[model samples]
Target: MVKFYQHTFSFEHAWDNVTYAFWLRYPNPFASHVIGCDVIDRHVDPDTGVLRTTRLIHKQGVMPRWGRHLIKNADAYIVEESEVDPKTQTMVTRTKNLNHVRVMQVEETLTFTVHPENPKWTQVKTEARIVSEMRWGLTGRVENFGITKFMDNSVRARKGMAHILERLRHNAALAGTPVAAAATTGAPLDC
Candidate 1:
């Protein structure tokens, strides 16, 4: 069997401007002129296969804060996707690995979703999963084995975080938007 690497980053927000930028920058070859961001809630019923919450992000000027964050993550994060013999009933039947149990596990699908909130916001939903008839590992990444290392210590993390926030704040100011007075209160842009 062969495996290929696929990288994907998705940002679903309510900011039309940000959505415009995303649609313009990452998803397509053309650039967008929209601004602002918001969240889109999609309610899909697995039992009935009914899908709802079909929202579209549309903006033509400056984007929202969350949108900016999405852009940043797209530029920095490292992602990869590949296919394997997903655990399915058919797979187990053909592999001859197990037959006495009368169970079959075939191919599996893996996907990782990372959404980092603002610097001020700490909690986030970072997920790595396999979607199939059964569940798989939800384990964390191994230590010292990631894409890139930006910081060496708490000071570095704090400093890096501050620099990122400062850049966002600066961009907001440049866009003629009301700068969050407390956005860079103590976080100096030392990078």
Candidate 2:
């Protein structure tokens, strides 16, 4: 069986700023489990003008103590792929673990866009699916644990993004540039 989760949230910042923050969300205090992140591939689609990126993230101490015997290592790798379309002011990202499929697999997708009621604000939709194929009546327990952990991680991820967004706002102010102007002009962010 698979467990699913969905949520919608908004940030009090512009869509451009929110999308920019997504690229700099790692290494925050809220995500101390993240050990390293590397960009494996990045390029702009010639026809669509959409920016595409693939990243590999290394995380440690992610496994629960009860399940430690099933997996040899406490470390895990995740593959993240994202597409950003500046014209439409939309960004979509998908991520999934690269190891430990037998115990459980968690896949998450996030979409960012401008809020309908407020142009200066950004809306985000998050969806996730967690599945476990383990036998001996352990499937349900494994799936429950996966979903719970996923929810906790989601909260941490949001806090990390908020932290990065606030930093961007402060830097923009110091540079004497409006956040919207900096986002629209594609100014290089300090992140």
Candidate 3:
């Protein structure tokens, strides 16, 4: 079975600043479950000037007691692919878990664009698909649990992004620089 979810939200920050902050979002206070993030590959297109990146993320996950029998550990490895088109002021990202698919698999896509009504703000559209391949009555239970957990995680993830964006805003004000410029300084945002 496949379960789907979608959400639309806006950030009070500009597209450039929001996209820049996305690269620095991992170590934010709201995302303590994320243990590690490493860039697997990254490059800027010479002709298009678009930035593309692949990253690996390690997250300490929570699994229901019943799920313990299906998987030995709750740790999850995720692969993320992202592209940022500076010219178009748009960013798109897709992520999926690399482990524990037999129990459940959740895939999510996110798009960031300049807000139509407010140029200074950015709009984010999130879409997710949850699937479980288990046979028998266990499939329904697992997929239902997957959707519930997904919604909970989504809320926390949004808070994490907002937390990172606020820090960027603060840093920009403190340094008397653009938020994007502050984001480029490679400072760790770890709590």
Candidate 4:
């Protein structure tokens, strides 16, 4: 069985700042489970002028009592791919687990763009799919667990982004530049 989840939310920050915050979202207080993240490849498309990045993330897994026996290693590896188009002012990111596909697989995609009603704010749309093919009548229970864990992780990821955005705003303020302007000017923060 497969479980799907979708959510739409807004960040009270400019789209540029929101996208920038995404790069620094890790190591935040809310995402303590994220142990390490590394950029495997990054480049700009010369023809389209879009920046593309591929990253690998290592996260410590937290399994339920019933699931502990299913998964031997309490760790997960995720692959994240993202594209940023400055001309269109849009960013799209997709992430999925690279391991433990037999037990369960969780895939997520997020899109960021300027809010329609408020240009100063950014809108984010999130979509996720969870699937489990475990036999012995464990498919339903495993899929349920996958969906619940995905939702909880989504909340933490948002909080982590917010924390980074606030820090960027504070630093921009101290530098006598608005966050929006800093994003446009590519001004470096003193942090």
Candidate 5:
């Protein structure tokens, strides 16, 4: 058996009272692998008074192929600068023990910054890490181990990403800002 995996990071560095959101999708698999994530859902510091909220979803596959066992089709969603429960108190909140998955570890961090255009706007930064392991034993024990498990992990990521892009367009319309090409000279690098 072999393992395949991918890593990605994204952020909205500058905006006025903006709510950023996006999703991440993993196209392959990893064995005994670690997945780490940090989300800065909200921030109110001396420098920045910005707020961010995120929702993450993950799905994994466990099946045996004709030639070898493999894991495929994992996805995640990270909605930023949304909203949160006032009762809760944390710069970053995480959903540990993701359902029907083996999670070895999870960690996160959030940083705050103040926006010049709107002092009410806050710049938020976050980093997250996750660790996971392959689980083929369960499927192998089942009656049909040959059935391919096309786990769709990116459902939330897809929804969030689309929502954020749409919102950005709407905001631009309200501000009467001209739309530019998707790949502009000043566009941020997609990592």
Candidate 6:
């Protein structure tokens, strides 16, 4: 079975600074589950003037009591691929957990673009898919659990990014430098 989720929101900051904060978001307080993040590869595409990046993230997973037996140790590694097009002012990211696939797999895609209503704000779209390949009648249960857990994680992830963006704004203010992509609260829609 497969489960899907989608949400749309805007950061009252610029696309540049918001994307910058995204790169620095992992270590924030809201994401304590994230232990380590490393840039595996990064380069700018010569023709497109787009920055492409790959990162590996390690997270200390948390599972429900019923899931403890299935996911021993509860540690996970995530692989993330991203593309940032400076010319177009857009950023796209895809991520999936590399381990514990037999039980459940969660794939997420996030896109950031300059808000149509306000150039100073950045618009964000989030989409996720969860699937469980398990059989023996466990597939349904696992998929359901996956969806719930994924939504919870998504909330935490958004909060983490928001925290990082705020920090950037505060630091920029302290340093007395113009924030290139700083964001503030904007019209947000979650569904």
List per-candidate RMSD values in Å. Answer: 18.9, 1.9, 2.1, 2.2, 12.4, 5.5
Cα lDDT tens digits for candidate 3, 1-95: 69999999999988878887788788877788999998888889999999889999999988888878888889999999999998999999999
List lDDT for all candidates, in order: 0.26, 0.88, 0.88, 0.89, 0.34, 0.85
Q: What lDDT score is found at residue 128 in candidate 1?
A: 24
TM-score of each candidate? Answer: 0.20, 0.93, 0.93, 0.94, 0.30, 0.92
Best by lDDT: 4
Ranking by lDDT: 4, 3, 2, 6, 5, 1
| Location of the lowest summed lDDT over 10 successive residues in candidate 6 | 182-191
Q: For candidate 2, which ten residues in a row score worst on lDDT?
A: 182-191
Question: Candidate 6, residues 54-90: lDDT per residue as tens digits?
Answer: 9988999888887798877798999999999988999
Best by TM-score: 4
lDDT of 5 by residue, 1-191 (tens): 22222323233322221223222212213211214334433343433443444544333333345413332433333333333222231234334334423422233344334444544434445444444443555423322221111113223333444455555566567767732232122443111
lDDT tens digits by residue: candidate 2, 97-167:
89888888889999999999999899999999999989989899999998898889889889999998898
Instruction: Point out the worst 10-residue segment of candidate 4 by lDDT.
Output: 182-191
Candidate 3 overall lDDT versus native? 0.88
Higher-lDDT candidate among 4 and 6? Answer: 4
Give candidate 4 misplaced runs (Cα > 4 Å): 184-191
Worst 10 residues of 3 by lDDT: 182-191
lDDT value, candidate 2, whole model: 0.88
